[model samples]
Target: MISGLIMDIMGLHRFAFHSQVGYTWVILAFVHLVFNWGKVKAYWRHRFRLHPHQDLPTPPKQLQQLEHTQKSDRRSLFFSLLAMAGGFILGRLLPTGQTVDFSSQKTDGGMFYHQWSKLGYPQALRAILNWGEQPARYKTYGDARQIELPDPKGYQGLSLESAIATRRSQRDYLNAPLSLVDLSRLLHLACGITHAPGELRAAPSAGALYPLEVYPVVHRVEGLQSGIYHYAIQQHKLELLQPGDFRAAVVTAGLGQNFLGQASVCFVISGIFQRTRWKYHERTYRYVLMEAGHMGQNLYLGATSLGLGACAIGAFLDDALNHLLGLDGQKEAALYLITVGRVETG
Candidate 1:
């Protein structure tokens, strides 16, 4: 209990230690029950009148002793109940605004959101009565410089099985510019629309509502300037949002992860939650994060297929990244990042 309290104070997780202690406690309790099995049986038989047919006459002194034992047991049970009630009240009195990361001052947002988004009777009724209107399926940049990408098909390198087998989280990268076609292929396979008719994408999205938006922070790619570009998924083109070197900015936004600056491109995946929120309601957050994971895995496999290194990064300054992509961090926010780069191979 003291160790758990210390961990809580330090903002470190105590689940592992709590789990071990819980198991040990259960084993010790079982052993205790075994050792006192005879006494337990006697108490149970007396309490339940196990032998109703047999009338066992009791001595006066023994009867007094039995009554005293029963009173003590009742008192113990009463005190245990009272202690539990006190603990519950104490938990209710504790502050709920505690921050998760001491350095960033980032509160336990996930836990807060999880509790807020629970589907109770009232929430279920609200969902049924007023399902909000859905947002547009695709995001576009009107005046941004558009770069037509090479056909994302027919230029495959490795087989599906081979790609899966060789897929790894590679952090170390070589200082080499990636081919334009390879970049195109990576973006397409990550989340591009594979089926044009229904707007189905490579990564599976809940309710066919693609809430994710992909932005590539380009470091070095052939024929493309070092800048931040948004992937126009519908047209399979790149829309250059900011055309300048962003290696330093990206490195800072990624919490000083130098690999993000060294990589050929870092794909920043954001979610416009309203797209899924209209339909999924309370569970929208869960679905949006799951979709990001699906897209990240796709990027991993795609990079592996092209014999390149790929690393999915979840640790980063959320506000800084959203600012870099011109997102407001609320209606639309960055959720995941994947860095793809050239690597030495045998």
Candidate 2:
């Protein structure tokens, strides 16, 4: 009664306050509850389907309440992100109302976008230069023979440190072939067998959710049949994918990058998110990228040690690549590409 009397004396309209602020809060609360209920219901349905026999409480009343709380938390986060995006877009778009005194500043400095223009990164990294002298395209597909070496120096000289130090993007190749032993060794070191004898397994996957698939593109590796091969890590052998000199098509798929053209072989890292995301839903994306990096580094180190060449490729025609690998880019989609070759030199 005292508080009511104090409010009346202040002439503060209680009905207006209640209708404005209280109504907004109640609406938000209702939406939050509804959003959470939907989320929890879907989760429960998926969970029930996955583990039908598990002795768990049915997700109706209590689960709805718990999910509503979580949804509230998530809504707050989403709104915060929306606010940031809105502010950033507004700032960028809004006109400068007035020009301030700028005599003290350097002439080169300007706004953020203008400053970006100063740091001249190549407009695009996939610019390809055609050569008049192309190595005679070896027409034969499935044949094994001793590979030809241009000079003994390319093969005889061997050191990991030197190999790494002198690495360059060399796409022009002498008409020499890559050896089978070299091919085998490269495959072993980059992506070889582990102790997983299970019918379907990959190198220690997150939640045993092995998500990566490796494919090799073969062009001029000798004593080994020329064809695309699947690295059977368990068997430590190549499962032939297709027989052809598909380098041109693969290089084109890789956005016409010259290094891919000169590469004797390449590795395509594919992912099966279901194998992982089933266990770790949202965060599985992070793990998948991390795993790709790990595999890429392995290729680099393995190539360095074997006195061969390897380069990780990020730019590629995503859809064409999927087609090149005969993949749908859905279930087991390629994540990374690595080109490997016997580095050519003077």
Candidate 3:
């Protein structure tokens, strides 16, 4: 999937190739499941039936039984390798003349429009009529300590035009700690609530679903311990989620981008798709990604206005980041990241 996405982003027409690979992968996966069905069933049975206080199952009893188990393991490993080889051969032997015409493809404004067009008229009508009420505006994490952000209205910053004109993807940062005030202002401008009465935010949302959530990984912020923190939009506060410096892990997850470790703080924007999916259905995915882009721009501009350096990052290990932030990949997943810090000036 990641390979397909990279190919698409680079305008490489390899759909036929990817399709063959996908078919081969499915075949191998099916064979694997079939071969391991016995073990799989036993594992699940033990997982469900065993009491919490019960001891783990003992190993094979006799030497003969142990030898038999080792033989089975060897056979499984051999078959797995054979399946991989077969898959490679099958993928290579498949026809590949049918190439996708990237140039001739019609752009229907965006993917959201294309997805909407696929829905039946009756379903579309029902969707519009039954659009569910907005979900909770703020996300809270148990009894985590919250630090209220500074009032955004009182923030002092450069003009929008000035920020835009001078904005750059800054990769170099000074070895200086970011002040709490600067961090608060940056978060407020990026996604914090702008109007409390209407539940509106600094960034616009499709249908006001506002599916995006912000998390800041602190490294060198003054008056704050290094940890992962979630932003609560309703109260405009930061809730501590995990406490520890994770700059090294973050850099590894970001494909060894040393600059990420150097930054004072990194903002990770995640999406909870169900919020918008209730109304837009499949179109919600497109809207969620678009929302991330909007927030990225806001972060860049916000950082620029505050005389700080910022860079938006997209190339990172998805699963690694999801694990680091303690988010389930399906429900709430990391979509984008931005690193911010003071720019070094000689």
Candidate 4:
């Protein structure tokens, strides 16, 4: 049983081996049960008092020894069952390559239908119920320093086809500092609001509920302090969150990916789930993840357009990044990262 559970946890699901072990275990259990039939009968007789008028007979020395052995076996079986159950639950919770469908028709939706539509909740109701006071479009810090970004309009010069053709994940970067104009263009194209009237942004969000937030970790940006800064999309500026260089900490959070610290700037994308959860409910998670992907792609293409190298990083310690950014893992958590810098040329 222990070996079977270990194989399952390691994703080594050899059907032939598992089947053989399973059948053998079942047969052994049956045989053991048959061998203990006398003890089983005696136990039931004593427990239920089926023979109330007949006094219980004392067992002989060998029978007592057998009873003792059966008790020990029962105890071992109980612990084994517990260990198997615990291993199964742990394996299910751990990350695996296999895709598991958590959605149910009753909760997620039916064919050509979703839970949001089934609820019959209007957009106006969502605004009133989910966000009564209208959540701020931009996040602000009280005493932290701020850096106003350059105009983003002047930075859009690259053609769409050219940017798409040249887009690639770049890991090697020159030891250089990115200019403020380049940083402005990257953030604006990635997530900044394009249309202020309807609160629309460069990336398409589900139901216009922009749940994604951008944080730029400045490593070597020219004219910018080395610190963690929150990108205020609406204002098109940076709000300093923490002072001092975090290149070392970022590398640690990124699981020793030294290239992360070499970038001119690293974008940390986080999601505020409740923003979308109010309307989509159980399906909110899917939208949040999709939104993150959309923003990451935008950053990639935007960096390419600006003639800078960009790499989308997915492998990182979730808790480490959250702690580095001063975010609670539940309400707001880092979902993705993008490192951008000048491409090294020979």
TM-scores of the models, in the order given = 0.67, 0.51, 0.65, 0.63
Per residue, candidate 1 scores C-alpha lDDT tens digits across 17-66 of 66577689989999999999999998767764533334678776877776
Ten contiguous residues minimizing lDDT sum, candidate 2: 123-132
Instruction: Give the true-structure RMSD of model 2.
Output: 20.4
TM-score-wise, the better of 1 and 3 is 1
Go through the candidates in order and give each one's C-alpha lDDT. 0.85, 0.61, 0.81, 0.81
Q: For residues 268-323, could you state the per-residue lDDT of candidate 2 as single tens digits? A: 88876666655454445677877888777767766665656678899999899888
| lDDT of each residue in 1-346, candidate 3, tens digit only | 3343334333233335775777899899999999999999987564444242246555536444655655676678689898777766755674433334434655333442443335443334334335456577567886888887767668668899999999999989899999998998888888988887788999999998899999999999999999999998888889999999999999999999999999999999999878887778656778899999999999999999999999999999999999999999897899999999999642
Among these predicted structures, which one has the highest lDDT?
1
Ranking by lDDT: 1, 3, 4, 2
lDDT, residue 245, model 3: 91
Q: Candidate 1: which stretches are off by over 4 Å?
A: 1-109, 115-123, 128-131
lDDT score at residue 190, model 3, on the 0-100 scale: 88
Better of 2 and 3 by lDDT: 3
TM-score of 4: 0.63
After the best TM-score superposition of candidate 1, give how far the Cα of residue 101 lies from its true spot, in angstroms.
19
Give per-residue lDDT, candidate 4, residue 164: 90
Best by TM-score: 1
Write model 4 residue lDDT over 159-214, tens digit each, in one string: 99988988889999999899998899889989988987997999999999898999
